[model samples]
Target chain A: MNWHLIAAQLLNGLALGSILALVALGLTITFGLLGLVNFAHGVFFMVGAYAGFVTFQYTHSFGLAVLMGALVVLVVGIVVERVVIRLFYRRPPEDQILVTFGLAIVIVEIVRAIFGGKTQLFPMPSWGMGATNLGFLVYPNYRLQVIVIAAITLAAIYLVLYKTRLGLIVRAGIDDSLIVNILGIDVTKTLLAVFVLGAMVAGFSGVIDAPIVAVDPDMGASVLIESFVVVVIGGLGSFSGSILGGIIAGEIISITTIWAPDYAQVMLYLAMALVLILRPQGLFGTEGRL
Target chain B: MMLRAIGDRSTWRVELAVAVFLIAFPWVFPIIGGYANLATRILILGLFGIGMDLIFGYTGMLSFGQAAFYGTGGFVTAYLLSTGMLHNTLGALAAGTIAAACCGMIIGYLCLRQSGVYFAMLTLAFGEVFYFLENSPLAKWTGGENGLPGLPKPVIPLGFTTLHVQSNLALYYFVAILFFVGYWVARRIVRSPMGAVLRAILENPARAAAVGHNVPKYKLAVFTIAAAYAGIAGGLLGIFQGYMPPDAFSIDQSGEIIIMTIIGGAGTLIGPLVGAGLWSYLREALQNLHGVGAFWKLILGLLFIVLVTLFRRGITGGITDSIGLFRVRRRTAAAHVEEAPAVSGEVQP
Candidate 1:
């Protein structure tokens, strides 16, 4: 067995997993709080990449690009929540899915109209251009940075969700919104905050992932579906589950790519199906929460 | 009494009306600037949406993975015909439909364990699995990205005389006949006692189960039937275009069918057909207009959002609702007039 190759792939999987965890975290929280299956989440990811790309074109600073990616999507999320998602709270789950799916199409087409449908390259940030040599394998510095950034972001989210008063309300609401409402906490504000936070995370990951993957109008479709797998594997509304599910999905894809590249995605889906069949509520997910 | 008779299930007025519409669509559509090929495509999508309506509209299972069966049925039939394994077109279509139905049964069994959003996500993931399988692993048989091309036009053997569907009109008629049968079957299912159970499940699964109906069994059955509809439609698409495009298995295909079903009106059997016609016609028309080609989807998306938000019942639903309301108002007015005369007679006595 080539231990060195395995080690390299493992690290690559971690990097991929971190990004997926970040994306899934956003989806999980909104679903937990709002019970909305936001199909437009993927479009937000694409919008972030484009936002960052445009920012980088002008500022030429990856930091500013990242900030702009998050900020633009943050505003976009706010508008979408206020104008559209707010109305859907009383609607059925299928209605929410359909509206958001429509929103995704609209947003993607708008992007396509502004920037042609062709794939665009997001250059590696100047600071993240080189390779870092570990004992076993040399890896891209940007990917390592992504891991660090995602970890910090995840940690920050953890603090907000667990350590703060608002976090308590959010968590409680996830368990039972009606009970939380009866407790005199403002559930509406908390819901808005969580939704926007999820959107920002999606945007942030999209910009960070820009250098790694091709940037295109339709890029978010696959990411959205993958994150759905992650959310399912982690159990809907479970933070730790998202992280674990993301890593597992990442490892399954990367490791499978080593032998059968074509089966990487298939393996990820199979793993999800198995998780669903074996433990429908997910490994960390509490049953009946959703 | 006459109105009740007209509305009775024994009367085939609705069926007759639909038949007239189908027969006249080819000619009427051209008047509205739609061509033969677009009409055929509408029928195919409409047939696919009928199955979706059965599951979603009546059964209340909003699946996002129907393309799995669609592409499965299309590819299987296309592969069989293209490889010369199936000499009869109808046989290949049947084979494809059955293959898709089996897939649906398996997928439905697994997915039915969950309901609502979880179910949607699971189906979407599974749909992607089929898509990836087609794009990579099964590419040898499926023709990968290029898709299976050079499929022969549909030829139906009637035992005594064979029907060669060669002309565009002939192909349209061939697909139309199948669609009519599919529509008729779907109507039967919706009106049947079993359909009432499906509706009960849709309205309230807990209550449906409380009433001794097996909810899961009903869901799976309807889901399988829906898959059969998608399968036959997929097979027809392969024959219609004479080439099975890989996009048949795409998420877009699945999403678009749902959009069509919803936009036309769910729970209404003809709703999908109306939605398909509108969607296909608008798509073609918008794409042809100057400077509007690229933004057509964007416009449609905006329109879909508006409809979902404001007109939840969709075009056909809204029309039927208004018509019903008008009839009710007229009937009440007539009743009030008769009551006044009776009151005057009593006062005279």
Candidate 2:
């Protein structure tokens, strides 16, 4: 393939990876730290998108949309954690999966009801709309912005987890939830914050993704499956793993599309299967976890 | 020793009841607010759900891609019937079933090698592949986006009078018969020694393997059986609808089946019928009701969450458990001849 085509595809991959990384960040942290699978995380992403879409509609401002989407989903995440999810913490992993799966259905259905089944389109901000000319290749400016935004968000999360007190507690709890519990730390509040934060990321991804992809109730399901691939590929709880997995998945998808357009999407799973068979713990995953 | 003997008898009774119900459902349902079309749809969906129940409910494998087999079976039957390569309807249906089973065998072999969530994701990937394949490369035979239409109604010829099964009542009876027989067969398979093994696999796969059960073979066997059920159901769907929608292969279709099983009651034969009935009925009702369109799905989704949160056992399980309590009360009283009948009567809800 020519440089233009290759560059274009790489851009697409990186942009897509950014979204995956954003969404998987929540899943990885909650799963990594709290030991909750959070199957409803995708629905969180959808809700965030809807929140963004609505805020934009009302204010006619993209910035406000991101704020509203993130805030609303944060609340939603906490409510979910306090309500249905609280009872499941002590249950079996399978039960957790089932409950969350049911919650996902409920959330998606509610979104569908509130916003019709039609795709909700987010208008790109004036600055994010145009294409950028990169000497030999042309790229969508919106996609490039996504990469920048995603990188910033990733950095922010890294700072929070590595540099903040709450992040320290979460990491400590992740290593030994029982120890934290025995230490008389309010693990509940920490989990609630982490859940909200994770949810906010999912929402943020949704709003950011709106301009690039069609927004709908079922959108989260496909993305959710892909994120699972990312999580599996990147070690389940490793933040760095998610970024790596997301980028690899994005490239795999983009490159596959160049080679075989139809199989592009399917190849993601094939790659996942290959990875699982070869390295069950994933690239950044510890073998002990598997 | 006593528990084993009672378990064996209870299993036999459950199997017998399922058989009788299937045989009687067609004859009895038409009199009770049920249409032939609805019955036919239920049977096809029920057949498909059986496969799902086996994988998700019994084997604890939450697959999100059964539509692959359903579509594959439908396409094969439609292609064979449409091309006139298979004149006999029964023969075509058989071939369709076999094709689906073979596909299941291959996919299951690969998928069952992984456990839990990985298995679920793998199935979903394969499903997406099948969808792409059907819509693209196999479009010529599959009819692509439009899907194959004009599948002829099956006919059964008798010596005295050839039964020309076509039109409303006739087609209903034909489908009813197929569903009845299929349901009866499923009940047998579920109660068989093999079904026991599948259940064991679900309860604790590691322990089951530790006990010397060939877990993978059982998983693969059930997966194939489920696929075969989906295939036959898919074929019946083509026959019943007179056209198989391409959406049958869509992930949405697979998701709907999962919802149905969860709603009705997992690990119960009659659960699918109740689930499909509730889902289809609500969909129609909600759509017909004023001020609701696609939002009906939203309502259903909420209902699903409430159900899962409130009643994991589902409608069939709830009823069965209640009935079981009454039976226990009676049996416990019977064990003590001194107990009064009034005590047992008070226990009934």
Candidate 3:
């Protein structure tokens, strides 16, 4: 391939990578701290995207739309935790997974009933609408914005997880929730906050991704699976690993598309399967969990 | 001694009555429900649900990839039979089931290592991958998004006469027979030692492992068995409907099986069949009701959530428990009567 095409593919890879990072971050925290799979996280993402779409129609302001979307999703997440998920925390992981799976179906079906099954469109805001032409290649302006936003968000999350007390508790919970409780800290509030934060992160991803992909009730289904690959590749709960995994998956999809466009998605699963064979806990994950 | 003998005989009688009802379901349903096509569809879906129940209910593995094998087996059989390569329908269907089992082995090998949600996600990836393959690259073989149409009905050579298993009534008979056979086989599997081990794994993998059971092997075996059952059921769908739609590979297909199993009662052999019958019947009935176009799925979702919240044991399990309660009450009453004479003798002394 020519350098221009390669460069374009690289940029596309970055766009996909950014989305993966955002989604994986949502999964990483919930899985890392709460030890719950949260199969409905994808539904949360869809809800956020749909909320953003609605908000944008009303206010015509992207920032306002994102804030509204994130807030709505945050509330939904907390409500789910209080009603269904809290009961699952003490049960088997499979029960939590199935319950969330059922809840996801409910959420998606509700959205479909309300919005109809057709794909809904959201225009990229004026600031992120145009293309940027490099000397070697041209790239979508919105995609470039996604990269910048993702970097900032990733850094922000890193700070929240590493520097802040909440982050410390989450990290502690990740290592061992029992130990965190033994330390006489209020782990309950920490869990509730982390659940909300995870939902917000997913919400952010949804808002950002709405313009690039068609916003539909079933939109989150595929993205949810891809995010799983990222989490597995990057190592669950490892911040840097998520970034690395996201990039690797993005490149895998983009580069494979060059060879066989149809096999791009299949190849990603094959890659995940291979990874599972080689490292069951994932690339950067600690051993023994699996 | 007489009471114990009577109890055993009554249990056998109930089982025999249930078996007779299932055997006559196809012949009798049309008279009651006014739609035999719907009943056949329910049976096909029920068979698929039984396979899923084995994996999720017994083995404790929640897979989202059952549809992958279903689609693969279906398309393969359809292509072969339609292309004139495989003349014998039974042979072609058997090959399809075996092929799906092979696919299951490959997927299970990679996925079984990762337990819980990760395994579920991985299966989802595999399912999507298979869907993509069927949609684009292998469209020539799979017939792409439209799916393979013109699937022929199976014919059996009875030596004395050839029986053409065609039309709704005939296909209904064919599918009903297979459903019964599949149900019988699955029941046997559930009652076998392997089934007990699978239940053990579901209860506690660590304990199962510590107890010297090859947990992974059992998991893989059960997964393959489930895939085989899914494959056969899928093949029957193509033969029954005369068309294999791409929707078979959709996430909805996998989700439908999960919902059917949960709604019917997991861990019980007949739960999925009952669940499938209820779900399919409800959907058809609701759809036919005016002003319920796409809202039917939404209504079902609400129903599912309510069921999960209230009837975690599902319909079949709930009924079984109620029946069990009644039986226990009768037995306790008999025990009270038996004790009365002994108490009177003690009072006299």
Candidate 4:
């Protein structure tokens, strides 16, 4: 009944969704291009957060932290692709899941071993702090910044994926991997780049959002599961689909928190279940992809 | 020979060997630095693993929500006992199992419609939902975070005397008997026509359905069966520990079960027992080791990576493969010697 409350919740949803949008872009690419559901993607997010955390400790620069986070995860992704994931490219989806799952465990456990089980604080830069006034609303300055950053990131990624030659092949590759392979595109290299790009954004999301949520080793798990939900709802591989899915999931979770907090997760799951039942391929997913 | 056509060879020799091992386990265990409790834990996991194999290995359905059924059954039995509603332990355990199976049937109805990763994700979501429900909504009966404790041990009455299964030793024997029964039943199921149908589904779902088999229906059936098995294992956990913790429904529990199943080998029924034993031993050893506080998981993770990449079929599969190879080599060698003797005699003539 309270219009203001609804508006506030909507705004809150946007802030929360910005983080998910960033993460989902990478998930969409991996799922869309490689036909993989990388469970370890979340681990990369955590690793990125640590990368940012350490950079901030030394340099006290948020921008530097974000860059370090991205760079660290990119390098890690390359090593993982070569050492572990490349072997699974030809294997079944389950094998890929299990391998990545094992990798996730290793990454998380190593982080935990180093950091212990405590949650670390990542302070928002002073410039990104404080509140913004919009006549009818007052929102945190950091959150508003998150919305803009997420938008910019999406635009950049969009351009990279569509405008660049490699991006075109990536998109075309999504259409038909076999055909793309026959074209002598070095599908392996292309997929490796895609994986690295995906990991970078995931790490960036972790660094950017670390200020909002506690930086913990196991922080990536819930986010990872929710991201999967987003991908499923948006259609598995469509970039725009995940973006839309992320916003919707954020709104559903944020709005439900007002009435019944416990039911929020349940509602998100129910929404996904309904989507799967009604449209298996998702809202933007190609038919038969399911 | 008659049963071999249906993939139902009795394999009494193997069964007898296992029975002997189970009987001799307690004696050999102490010598190997193992304990009674560890054996009991292994047997329970073995039971649960068999059910997991039915779904994951036999039916080719990767479910990540088995802990839901486990928690459901464990809580049901624990709640009944805590409230004094169930006097007979066996009856309570049976009730708990039925409850878990019913849940599986309902969850499977919605989940089975999705295949591959989606199926796994849906199950994971449902499992988390159950955990939240048990934690917040049904906390009154399930004991929330503290969990239900102080459960009464079961008593068996003989014609002239009554036996109380209370101590760890007694519980081990009781559990061992149940484990044997469970294994026997699982073996029967694996040999049944339904098991063949399941394996067929695992091999190729589209082909299995095209050949007039109802793949989804079979999937649901095996899914329910697995839930029942998990339910029993959950109930046994409460009985063995004398308390049922809410952790039975956790993702970690499900993950551990998956790890154990994989390490032991998936398709083989005995794989779980071996896996559980190995995992538990590793855990105990790692936990007790100095300088390693919580990083034992890292070691296990490394082992998991190696196994997944190099030894995907697992310990049991590896053993069986090598054994088969050895037999083939011996047979070929014998045939070669026989040919040499025949050639020499012909040349002399």
Which rank order by lDDT, best down to worst? 1, 4, 3, 2
Between candidates 1 and 2, the one scoring higher on TM-score is 1
Query: What is residue B187's positional error in candidate 4, in angstroms?
Result: 1.1
Ranking of all candidate structures by their DockQ, best first: 1, 3, 4, 2
Instruction: Give the per-residue lDDT digits (tens) of candidate 2, residues B46-144.
Output: 778878887776677777779999998988988888787876777788888899999999888877767665566667767877887889777888898
Measured against the true structure, the TM-scores of the candidates, in listed sequence, are 0.95, 0.90, 0.93, 0.93
Q: Which candidate ranks first by DockQ, i.e. highest?
A: 1
Candidate 2 local lDDT, residue B60 = 72
lDDT of 2 by residue, A89-181 (tens): 765565577778778877887776677689867777888977889887878889999999999999999999999998888888878889888
**Per-residue lDDT of A282 in model 4:** 82
- Proportion of true inter-chain contacts also present in candidate 3: 0.72
**Which candidate comes out best when scored by lDDT?**
1
- Note the residue pairs that clash in candidate 1: none
A61-154: candidate 4 lDDT, tens digit per residue: 9999999999999999999998989888877777788888889999999898888878999989888989978778887888888889989999
Per-prediction CA RMSD (Å)? 6.3, 5.7, 6.7, 6.8
Per-residue lDDT tens digits for candidate 3, residues B1-349, read: 0112113225445345546765677677766564778878888888888789889877779898899889878887888788878877887889889998999998888888887777888888788888898999999888898898887778777779878876777777788777778876776686668977887777667778998999999999999999998998888888777788888899889888988898887766577877888888778777878888567777777777777666766777666655554565444523322231122113221
lDDT of each: 0.88, 0.78, 0.81, 0.83
Q: Write the per-residue lDDT of candidate 4 for residues B10-31, one digit (tens) a residue.
A: 3675566667777878778887
**Model 4 lDDT, residue B23, Cα:** 82
Top-down TM-score ranking: 1, 4, 3, 2
Among all windows of 10 consecutive residues in model 2 chain A, the one with the lowest summed lDDT is: A89-98
